[model samples]
Target: MTVRPASVDDLPAIADIYAHYVATSVATFELDVPDRDEWQRRHAAIAAARLPFVVTERDGAVAGYAYCAPWKARPAYRATVEDSVYVAPSAVGTGCGAELLPALLDMSRAVGVRQVIAVIADSGDEASVRLHRRFGFRDAGRLERVGYKHDRWIDTVLMQWSA
Candidate 1:
Protein backbone atom coordinates (compact mmCIF):
# COMPACT_ATOMS: atom_id res chain seq x y z
CA MET A 1 0.00 0.00 0.00
CA THR A 2 1.09 3.57 -0.60
CA VAL A 3 0.08 6.90 0.91
CA ARG A 4 0.33 10.15 -1.02
CA PRO A 5 -1.10 13.62 -1.46
CA ALA A 6 -4.69 13.61 -2.64
CA SER A 7 -5.88 15.28 -5.83
CA VAL A 8 -9.26 16.20 -7.36
CA ASP A 9 -9.42 12.82 -9.05
CA ASP A 10 -9.52 11.15 -5.68
CA LEU A 11 -12.51 13.17 -4.44
CA PRO A 12 -15.18 10.84 -5.79
CA ALA A 13 -13.69 7.87 -4.02
CA ILE A 14 -13.26 9.90 -0.89
CA ALA A 15 -16.89 11.02 -1.05
CA ASP A 16 -18.06 7.45 -1.46
CA ILE A 17 -16.03 6.29 1.49
CA TYR A 18 -17.30 9.08 3.72
CA ALA A 19 -20.89 8.79 2.51
CA HIS A 20 -21.08 5.33 4.01
CA TYR A 21 -20.10 6.63 7.40
CA VAL A 22 -22.56 9.45 7.11
CA ALA A 23 -25.40 7.19 6.09
CA THR A 24 -24.74 4.16 8.27
CA SER A 25 -22.59 5.12 11.23
CA VAL A 26 -22.16 7.75 13.89
CA ALA A 27 -18.47 8.06 13.12
CA THR A 28 -19.41 11.39 11.69
CA PHE A 29 -22.45 13.42 12.70
CA GLU A 30 -23.14 14.54 9.17
CA LEU A 31 -26.65 13.52 8.18
CA ASP A 32 -26.24 14.21 4.48
CA VAL A 33 -23.81 12.71 2.03
CA PRO A 34 -21.82 15.58 0.58
CA ASP A 35 -21.55 15.63 -3.19
CA ARG A 36 -18.30 15.64 -5.11
CA ASP A 37 -18.67 19.38 -5.58
CA GLU A 38 -18.65 19.81 -1.82
CA TRP A 39 -15.59 17.60 -1.64
CA GLN A 40 -13.99 19.80 -4.27
CA ARG A 41 -14.67 22.89 -2.18
CA ARG A 42 -13.18 21.21 0.87
CA HIS A 43 -10.13 20.04 -1.06
CA ALA A 44 -9.65 23.51 -2.41
CA ALA A 45 -9.83 25.00 1.06
CA ILE A 46 -7.25 22.56 2.35
CA ALA A 47 -4.97 23.27 -0.56
CA ALA A 48 -5.39 27.02 -0.35
CA ALA A 49 -4.25 26.81 3.24
CA ARG A 50 -1.45 24.39 2.33
CA LEU A 51 -2.61 21.68 4.72
CA PRO A 52 -1.78 18.02 4.28
CA PHE A 53 -4.52 15.95 2.63
CA VAL A 54 -3.49 12.43 1.70
CA VAL A 55 -4.91 9.09 0.68
CA THR A 56 -3.74 5.50 0.95
CA GLU A 57 -4.20 2.98 -1.81
CA ARG A 58 -4.04 -0.78 -1.71
CA ASP A 59 -4.01 -2.95 -4.81
CA GLY A 60 -4.61 0.19 -6.85
CA ALA A 61 -7.78 1.07 -4.92
CA VAL A 62 -8.23 3.86 -2.44
CA ALA A 63 -8.21 2.08 0.90
CA GLY A 64 -8.46 5.13 3.12
CA TYR A 65 -7.58 8.76 3.61
CA ALA A 66 -6.57 11.34 6.25
CA TYR A 67 -5.86 15.02 6.56
CA CYS A 68 -4.89 17.79 8.97
CA ALA A 69 -6.72 21.09 9.12
CA PRO A 70 -6.23 24.22 11.13
CA TRP A 71 -7.43 23.76 14.66
CA LYS A 72 -9.22 27.08 14.68
CA ALA A 73 -9.33 30.34 12.82
CA ARG A 74 -7.29 32.43 15.23
CA PRO A 75 -3.64 33.00 14.49
CA ALA A 76 -2.84 31.81 17.99
CA TYR A 77 -4.02 28.37 16.96
CA ARG A 78 -1.93 28.23 13.83
CA ALA A 79 0.59 25.91 15.39
CA THR A 80 -2.12 23.43 16.27
CA VAL A 81 -4.04 21.22 13.86
CA GLU A 82 -7.03 18.91 13.88
CA ASP A 83 -6.86 15.56 12.14
CA SER A 84 -9.50 13.41 10.40
CA VAL A 85 -8.97 9.85 9.24
CA TYR A 86 -11.23 7.29 7.64
CA VAL A 87 -10.63 3.81 6.29
CA ALA A 88 -12.89 2.22 3.72
CA PRO A 89 -15.03 -0.48 5.29
CA SER A 90 -13.44 -3.04 2.99
CA ALA A 91 -10.07 -2.04 4.35
CA VAL A 92 -11.00 -1.98 8.01
CA GLY A 93 -8.51 -3.78 10.29
CA THR A 94 -5.88 -3.36 7.62
CA GLY A 95 -4.14 -0.64 9.66
CA CYS A 96 -5.04 1.93 7.03
CA GLY A 97 -5.82 4.73 9.47
CA ALA A 98 -2.87 3.74 11.59
CA GLU A 99 -0.54 4.05 8.66
CA LEU A 100 -2.26 7.10 7.22
CA LEU A 101 -2.25 9.08 10.46
CA PRO A 102 1.46 9.02 11.09
CA ALA A 103 2.10 10.19 7.58
CA LEU A 104 -0.13 13.21 8.23
CA LEU A 105 1.51 13.77 11.59
CA ASP A 106 4.94 13.67 10.00
CA MET A 107 3.84 16.16 7.36
CA SER A 108 2.31 18.39 10.04
CA ARG A 109 5.52 18.32 12.04
CA ALA A 110 7.63 19.07 9.04
CA VAL A 111 5.47 22.10 8.38
CA GLY A 112 6.10 23.36 11.95
CA VAL A 113 2.76 22.38 13.41
CA ARG A 114 3.32 21.85 17.13
CA GLN A 115 0.30 19.76 17.99
CA VAL A 116 -2.49 17.63 16.54
CA ILE A 117 -6.04 17.11 17.80
CA ALA A 118 -8.61 14.45 17.01
CA VAL A 119 -12.31 15.03 17.66
CA ILE A 120 -13.73 11.57 17.49
CA ALA A 121 -17.52 11.62 17.15
CA ASP A 122 -18.36 8.79 19.50
CA SER A 123 -16.56 7.77 22.65
CA GLY A 124 -17.53 4.23 21.79
CA ASP A 125 -15.53 4.27 18.58
CA GLU A 126 -12.87 1.93 19.83
CA ALA A 127 -11.04 1.52 16.54
CA SER A 128 -10.57 5.24 16.02
CA VAL A 129 -9.91 5.86 19.72
CA ARG A 130 -7.38 3.05 19.75
CA LEU A 131 -5.76 4.19 16.54
CA HIS A 132 -5.27 7.72 17.87
CA ARG A 133 -4.07 6.42 21.20
CA ARG A 134 -1.53 4.20 19.54
CA PHE A 135 -0.25 7.26 17.75
CA GLY A 136 0.39 8.91 21.16
CA PHE A 137 -2.81 10.94 21.39
CA ARG A 138 -4.26 11.21 24.90
CA ASP A 139 -7.69 12.06 26.13
CA ALA A 140 -7.82 15.81 26.43
CA GLY A 141 -11.55 16.25 26.98
CA ARG A 142 -15.00 14.78 26.41
CA LEU A 143 -18.39 16.32 25.87
CA GLU A 144 -21.37 14.35 26.97
CA ARG A 145 -24.26 13.99 24.56
CA VAL A 146 -22.83 16.69 22.40
CA GLY A 147 -24.19 15.18 19.24
CA TYR A 148 -27.43 13.49 18.29
CA LYS A 149 -27.23 10.95 15.52
CA HIS A 150 -28.72 7.63 14.55
CA ASP A 151 -31.75 8.51 16.65
CA ARG A 152 -29.71 8.77 19.83
CA TRP A 153 -27.52 11.16 21.72
CA ILE A 154 -23.81 10.64 21.27
CA ASP A 155 -20.70 11.90 23.00
CA THR A 156 -17.57 13.35 21.49
CA VAL A 157 -14.04 12.24 22.30
CA LEU A 158 -11.27 14.75 22.17
CA MET A 159 -7.73 13.48 21.87
CA GLN A 160 -4.57 15.47 21.44
CA TRP A 161 -0.90 15.01 20.55
CA SER A 162 1.70 17.60 21.38
CA ALA A 163 5.20 18.00 20.10
Candidate 2:
Protein backbone atom coordinates (compact mmCIF):
# COMPACT_ATOMS: atom_id res chain seq x y z
CA MET A 1 0.00 0.00 0.00
CA THR A 2 1.07 3.57 -0.70
CA VAL A 3 0.03 6.78 0.99
CA ARG A 4 0.10 10.11 -0.85
CA PRO A 5 -1.50 13.52 -0.96
CA ALA A 6 -4.96 13.34 -2.43
CA SER A 7 -5.96 15.07 -5.67
CA VAL A 8 -9.22 16.11 -7.27
CA ASP A 9 -9.44 12.76 -9.04
CA ASP A 10 -9.57 10.98 -5.71
CA LEU A 11 -12.71 12.70 -4.48
CA PRO A 12 -15.14 10.25 -6.01
CA ALA A 13 -13.54 7.34 -4.24
CA ILE A 14 -13.32 9.29 -1.05
CA ALA A 15 -16.99 10.18 -1.37
CA ASP A 16 -17.87 6.57 -1.93
CA ILE A 17 -16.05 5.42 1.18
CA TYR A 18 -17.69 8.09 3.27
CA ALA A 19 -21.08 7.42 1.74
CA HIS A 20 -20.91 3.83 2.86
CA TYR A 21 -20.33 4.84 6.48
CA VAL A 22 -23.01 7.54 6.32
CA ALA A 23 -25.53 5.10 4.91
CA THR A 24 -24.83 2.01 6.97
CA SER A 25 -23.35 3.20 10.23
CA VAL A 26 -23.51 6.01 12.74
CA ALA A 27 -19.82 6.73 12.39
CA THR A 28 -20.74 10.07 10.87
CA PHE A 29 -23.70 12.23 11.81
CA GLU A 30 -24.35 13.20 8.20
CA LEU A 31 -27.80 12.12 7.06
CA ASP A 32 -27.34 12.93 3.40
CA VAL A 33 -24.24 12.20 1.43
CA PRO A 34 -22.61 15.29 0.00
CA ASP A 35 -22.49 15.57 -3.73
CA ARG A 36 -19.44 15.95 -5.96
CA ASP A 37 -19.66 19.72 -5.89
CA GLU A 38 -19.64 19.71 -2.13
CA TRP A 39 -16.64 17.43 -2.08
CA GLN A 40 -14.86 19.75 -4.48
CA ARG A 41 -15.58 22.73 -2.31
CA ARG A 42 -14.35 20.92 0.79
CA HIS A 43 -11.15 19.91 -0.93
CA ALA A 44 -10.60 23.47 -1.96
CA ALA A 45 -11.12 24.74 1.56
CA ILE A 46 -8.68 22.29 3.07
CA ALA A 47 -6.11 23.06 0.42
CA ALA A 48 -6.53 26.77 0.96
CA ALA A 49 -5.70 26.26 4.61
CA ARG A 50 -2.62 24.27 3.70
CA LEU A 51 -3.90 21.26 5.59
CA PRO A 52 -3.31 17.62 4.86
CA PHE A 53 -5.74 15.61 2.78
CA VAL A 54 -4.39 12.23 1.78
CA VAL A 55 -5.28 8.86 0.36
CA THR A 56 -3.90 5.33 0.57
CA GLU A 57 -3.64 3.29 -2.56
CA ARG A 58 -3.55 -0.46 -2.80
CA ASP A 59 -3.08 -1.90 -6.25
CA GLY A 60 -3.55 1.55 -7.74
CA ALA A 61 -6.97 2.15 -6.23
CA VAL A 62 -7.93 4.42 -3.36
CA ALA A 63 -8.23 2.17 -0.32
CA GLY A 64 -8.77 4.91 2.21
CA TYR A 65 -8.59 8.64 2.82
CA ALA A 66 -7.90 11.04 5.71
CA TYR A 67 -7.89 14.77 6.25
CA CYS A 68 -7.82 17.51 8.89
CA ALA A 69 -9.92 20.66 8.95
CA PRO A 70 -9.94 23.62 11.28
CA TRP A 71 -11.60 22.67 14.54
CA LYS A 72 -13.26 26.02 14.74
CA ALA A 73 -13.41 29.19 12.70
CA ARG A 74 -12.21 31.46 15.49
CA PRO A 75 -8.59 32.60 15.31
CA ALA A 76 -7.94 31.17 18.77
CA TYR A 77 -8.41 27.72 17.30
CA ARG A 78 -6.15 28.22 14.30
CA ALA A 79 -3.51 25.79 15.44
CA THR A 80 -6.02 23.12 16.31
CA VAL A 81 -7.71 20.83 13.82
CA GLU A 82 -10.14 17.91 13.67
CA ASP A 83 -9.38 14.75 11.76
CA SER A 84 -11.50 12.33 9.77
CA VAL A 85 -10.53 8.96 8.30
CA TYR A 86 -12.50 6.39 6.36
CA VAL A 87 -11.50 3.15 4.74
CA ALA A 88 -13.15 1.21 1.98
CA PRO A 89 -15.12 -1.77 3.25
CA SER A 90 -12.80 -4.14 1.47
CA ALA A 91 -9.77 -2.47 2.97
CA VAL A 92 -10.87 -2.23 6.60
CA GLY A 93 -8.43 -4.86 7.87
CA THR A 94 -5.83 -4.22 5.24
CA GLY A 95 -4.06 -1.51 7.25
CA CYS A 96 -5.32 1.38 5.14
CA GLY A 97 -6.31 3.40 8.19
CA ALA A 98 -3.03 2.60 9.91
CA GLU A 99 -1.20 4.11 6.99
CA LEU A 100 -3.55 7.02 6.26
CA LEU A 101 -3.76 8.33 9.83
CA PRO A 102 -0.07 8.59 10.57
CA ALA A 103 0.52 10.27 7.26
CA LEU A 104 -2.21 12.78 8.03
CA LEU A 105 -0.79 13.47 11.48
CA ASP A 106 2.74 13.82 10.18
CA MET A 107 1.62 16.23 7.53
CA SER A 108 -0.37 18.17 10.08
CA ARG A 109 2.68 18.51 12.28
CA ALA A 110 4.77 19.59 9.36
CA VAL A 111 2.27 22.30 8.60
CA GLY A 112 2.40 23.69 12.19
CA VAL A 113 -0.64 22.08 13.68
CA ARG A 114 -0.31 22.01 17.47
CA GLN A 115 -3.27 19.86 18.36
CA VAL A 116 -5.41 17.29 16.57
CA ILE A 117 -8.85 16.28 17.75
CA ALA A 118 -10.98 13.39 16.66
CA VAL A 119 -14.71 13.57 17.30
CA ILE A 120 -15.75 10.01 16.71
CA ALA A 121 -19.36 8.95 16.90
CA ASP A 122 -19.98 6.31 19.51
CA SER A 123 -21.46 3.83 17.11
CA GLY A 124 -20.73 0.76 19.26
CA ASP A 125 -17.77 -0.03 17.02
CA GLU A 126 -14.66 0.53 19.07
CA ALA A 127 -12.31 0.19 16.14
CA SER A 128 -12.00 3.96 15.60
CA VAL A 129 -11.33 4.61 19.26
CA ARG A 130 -8.80 1.83 19.44
CA LEU A 131 -7.06 3.03 16.31
CA HIS A 132 -6.79 6.58 17.63
CA ARG A 133 -5.43 5.27 20.92
CA ARG A 134 -2.85 3.15 19.13
CA PHE A 135 -1.56 6.35 17.53
CA GLY A 136 -1.07 8.14 20.87
CA PHE A 137 -4.41 9.90 21.17
CA ARG A 138 -5.79 10.22 24.69
CA ASP A 139 -9.36 10.20 25.88
CA ALA A 140 -10.50 13.79 26.14
CA GLY A 141 -14.19 13.27 26.97
CA ARG A 142 -17.53 12.09 25.69
CA LEU A 143 -20.77 13.88 24.96
CA GLU A 144 -23.75 11.71 25.67
CA ARG A 145 -26.69 11.60 23.26
CA VAL A 146 -25.53 14.54 21.23
CA GLY A 147 -26.48 13.18 17.85
CA TYR A 148 -29.68 11.71 16.50
CA LYS A 149 -29.21 9.39 13.57
CA HIS A 150 -30.61 6.26 12.05
CA ASP A 151 -33.64 6.44 14.30
CA ARG A 152 -31.49 6.38 17.43
CA TRP A 153 -29.58 8.70 19.67
CA ILE A 154 -25.80 8.58 19.53
CA ASP A 155 -22.90 10.00 21.46
CA THR A 156 -19.49 11.30 20.48
CA VAL A 157 -16.13 10.34 21.87
CA LEU A 158 -13.55 13.06 21.87
CA MET A 159 -9.92 12.11 21.57
CA GLN A 160 -6.98 14.47 21.46
CA TRP A 161 -3.38 14.33 20.32
CA SER A 162 -0.98 17.17 20.93
CA ALA A 163 2.27 17.84 19.20
Candidate 3:
Protein backbone atom coordinates (compact mmCIF):
# COMPACT_ATOMS: atom_id res chain seq x y z
CA MET A 1 0.00 0.00 0.00
CA THR A 2 1.08 3.58 -0.63
CA VAL A 3 0.15 6.67 1.36
CA ARG A 4 -0.01 10.08 -0.23
CA PRO A 5 -1.53 13.52 0.03
CA ALA A 6 -5.21 13.71 -0.82
CA SER A 7 -6.10 15.57 -3.99
CA VAL A 8 -9.39 16.89 -5.36
CA ASP A 9 -9.87 13.65 -7.24
CA ASP A 10 -9.79 11.65 -4.00
CA LEU A 11 -12.74 13.42 -2.37
CA PRO A 12 -15.36 11.15 -3.90
CA ALA A 13 -13.73 8.03 -2.53
CA ILE A 14 -13.19 9.69 0.80
CA ALA A 15 -16.86 10.62 0.88
CA ASP A 16 -17.81 7.05 0.12
CA ILE A 17 -15.81 5.72 3.04
CA TYR A 18 -17.15 8.40 5.36
CA ALA A 19 -20.73 7.93 4.19
CA HIS A 20 -20.51 4.24 4.95
CA TYR A 21 -19.46 5.01 8.48
CA VAL A 22 -22.16 7.62 8.84
CA ALA A 23 -24.91 5.41 7.51
CA THR A 24 -24.12 2.06 9.13
CA SER A 25 -22.03 2.59 12.22
CA VAL A 26 -21.73 4.62 15.39
CA ALA A 27 -18.06 5.25 14.73
CA THR A 28 -18.77 8.76 13.52
CA PHE A 29 -21.36 11.10 14.97
CA GLU A 30 -22.59 12.54 11.70
CA LEU A 31 -26.32 11.85 11.56
CA ASP A 32 -26.76 12.82 7.93
CA VAL A 33 -24.44 11.64 5.26
CA PRO A 34 -23.21 14.57 3.23
CA ASP A 35 -23.20 14.76 -0.54
CA ARG A 36 -20.06 14.81 -2.67
CA ASP A 37 -20.39 18.49 -3.46
CA GLU A 38 -20.35 19.50 0.18
CA TRP A 39 -17.60 17.04 0.91
CA GLN A 40 -15.57 18.60 -1.87
CA ARG A 41 -16.18 22.07 -0.48
CA ARG A 42 -15.05 21.05 2.98
CA HIS A 43 -12.01 19.31 1.60
CA ALA A 44 -11.17 22.30 -0.51
CA ALA A 45 -11.28 24.56 2.52
CA ILE A 46 -8.91 22.29 4.37
CA ALA A 47 -6.59 21.99 1.43
CA ALA A 48 -6.56 25.73 0.96
CA ALA A 49 -5.34 26.00 4.53
CA ARG A 50 -2.63 23.43 3.76
CA LEU A 51 -3.88 21.00 6.38
CA PRO A 52 -2.84 17.36 6.29
CA PHE A 53 -5.22 15.08 4.40
CA VAL A 54 -3.92 11.73 3.23
CA VAL A 55 -5.18 8.64 1.49
CA THR A 56 -3.95 5.06 1.55
CA GLU A 57 -3.98 3.24 -1.74
CA ARG A 58 -3.81 -0.49 -2.26
CA ASP A 59 -3.13 -1.55 -5.83
CA GLY A 60 -4.31 1.84 -7.07
CA ALA A 61 -7.58 1.89 -5.10
CA VAL A 62 -8.18 4.08 -2.10
CA ALA A 63 -8.45 1.84 0.94
CA GLY A 64 -8.57 4.44 3.65
CA TYR A 65 -8.06 8.10 4.49
CA ALA A 66 -6.74 10.21 7.38
CA TYR A 67 -6.65 13.94 8.08
CA CYS A 68 -6.05 16.44 10.82
CA ALA A 69 -8.22 19.52 11.32
CA PRO A 70 -7.86 22.43 13.65
CA TRP A 71 -9.24 21.54 17.05
CA LYS A 72 -10.60 24.99 17.65
CA ALA A 73 -11.08 28.31 15.88
CA ARG A 74 -8.68 30.65 17.57
CA PRO A 75 -5.12 31.44 16.63
CA ALA A 76 -4.15 30.50 20.17
CA TYR A 77 -5.26 26.96 19.33
CA ARG A 78 -3.19 26.80 16.15
CA ALA A 79 -0.64 24.34 17.45
CA THR A 80 -3.25 21.67 18.12
CA VAL A 81 -5.11 19.54 15.61
CA GLU A 82 -7.76 16.82 15.82
CA ASP A 83 -7.06 13.65 13.88
CA SER A 84 -9.56 11.57 11.89
CA VAL A 85 -9.20 8.25 10.12
CA TYR A 86 -11.69 6.26 8.07
CA VAL A 87 -10.83 2.91 6.55
CA ALA A 88 -13.10 1.26 4.05
CA PRO A 89 -14.83 -1.43 6.10
CA SER A 90 -13.29 -4.07 3.90
CA ALA A 91 -9.87 -2.61 4.53
CA VAL A 92 -10.06 -2.48 8.29
CA GLY A 93 -7.58 -4.64 10.24
CA THR A 94 -5.39 -5.02 7.16
CA GLY A 95 -2.93 -2.29 8.27
CA CYS A 96 -4.44 0.37 5.98
CA GLY A 97 -5.19 2.55 8.98
CA ALA A 98 -1.86 1.64 10.49
CA GLU A 99 -0.03 3.02 7.49
CA LEU A 100 -2.24 6.08 7.05
CA LEU A 101 -2.01 7.33 10.62
CA PRO A 102 1.77 7.57 10.79
CA ALA A 103 1.79 9.53 7.57
CA LEU A 104 -0.82 11.91 8.96
CA LEU A 105 1.22 12.38 12.12
CA ASP A 106 4.37 13.01 10.20
CA MET A 107 2.65 15.57 8.01
CA SER A 108 1.13 17.32 11.00
CA ARG A 109 4.51 17.55 12.68
CA ALA A 110 6.13 18.74 9.49
CA VAL A 111 3.74 21.68 9.45
CA GLY A 112 4.62 22.71 13.02
CA VAL A 113 1.71 21.18 14.83
CA ARG A 114 2.66 20.50 18.43
CA GLN A 115 -0.24 18.35 19.57
CA VAL A 116 -2.49 15.83 17.88
CA ILE A 117 -5.82 14.72 19.29
CA ALA A 118 -8.27 11.98 18.43
CA VAL A 119 -11.86 11.75 19.57
CA ILE A 120 -12.81 8.12 19.58
CA ALA A 121 -16.43 7.05 19.31
CA ASP A 122 -16.74 4.83 22.33
CA SER A 123 -15.23 2.06 24.40
CA GLY A 124 -16.60 -0.58 22.05
CA ASP A 125 -13.99 0.28 19.41
CA GLU A 126 -11.10 -1.38 21.15
CA ALA A 127 -8.94 -1.81 18.11
CA SER A 128 -9.10 1.85 17.15
CA VAL A 129 -8.31 2.87 20.73
CA ARG A 130 -5.37 0.50 20.75
CA LEU A 131 -4.15 1.89 17.46
CA HIS A 132 -4.02 5.43 18.82
CA ARG A 133 -2.36 4.25 22.00
CA ARG A 134 0.24 2.44 19.97
CA PHE A 135 1.12 5.73 18.30
CA GLY A 136 1.81 7.38 21.68
CA PHE A 137 -1.60 9.01 22.16
CA ARG A 138 -2.67 8.74 25.78
CA ASP A 139 -6.15 8.51 27.20
CA ALA A 140 -6.83 12.09 28.10
CA GLY A 141 -10.49 11.96 29.17
CA ARG A 142 -13.96 10.81 28.23
CA LEU A 143 -17.10 12.85 27.87
CA GLU A 144 -19.89 10.55 28.91
CA ARG A 145 -22.98 10.54 26.69
CA VAL A 146 -21.60 13.28 24.54
CA GLY A 147 -23.06 11.93 21.34
CA TYR A 148 -26.26 10.23 20.37
CA LYS A 149 -26.31 7.81 17.48
CA HIS A 150 -27.71 4.43 16.43
CA ASP A 151 -30.54 4.68 18.94
CA ARG A 152 -28.24 5.00 21.94
CA TRP A 153 -26.09 7.54 23.71
CA ILE A 154 -22.37 7.22 23.22
CA ASP A 155 -19.23 8.56 24.83
CA THR A 156 -16.38 10.43 23.23
CA VAL A 157 -12.99 9.34 24.46
CA LEU A 158 -10.38 12.01 24.12
CA MET A 159 -6.86 10.88 23.33
CA GLN A 160 -3.87 13.09 22.73
CA TRP A 161 -0.20 12.99 21.82
CA SER A 162 2.34 15.77 21.94
CA ALA A 163 4.59 15.92 18.92
Predicted model with the maximum TM-score: 2
Best-to-worst ranking by TM-score: 2, 3, 1
Instruction: Give the residue spans of candidate 3 off by over 4 A.
Output: none
lDDT of each: 0.91, 0.95, 0.90
Q: Tell me the TM-score of each prediction against the true structure.
A: 0.96, 0.99, 0.97
lDDT of 1 by residue, 1-163 (tens): 8999999999989999999999999988889999988999999998887889999998998999998889999999999989999989999998899789999999889888899999998746588998999989999999899889888999899999987
Better of 2 and 3 by lDDT: 2
Q: Against the true structure, whose lDDT is highest? A: 2
lDDT of 1 at 25: 94
Give the per-residue lDDT of model 2 (tens digit) for 41-130: 999999999999999998999999999999999999999999999999998898988998899999999999999999999988999999
Clashing pairs in 2: none
Model 2 TM-score, all chains together: 0.99
Instruction: Give per-residue lDDT, candidate 3, residue 162.
Output: 94
Ranking by lDDT: 2, 1, 3
Pairwise TM-score winner, candidates 2 and 3: 2
Q: Which stretches of candidate 1 lie over 4 Å from their true place?
A: none
Kindly report which residue pairs in candidate 3 clash with one another.
none
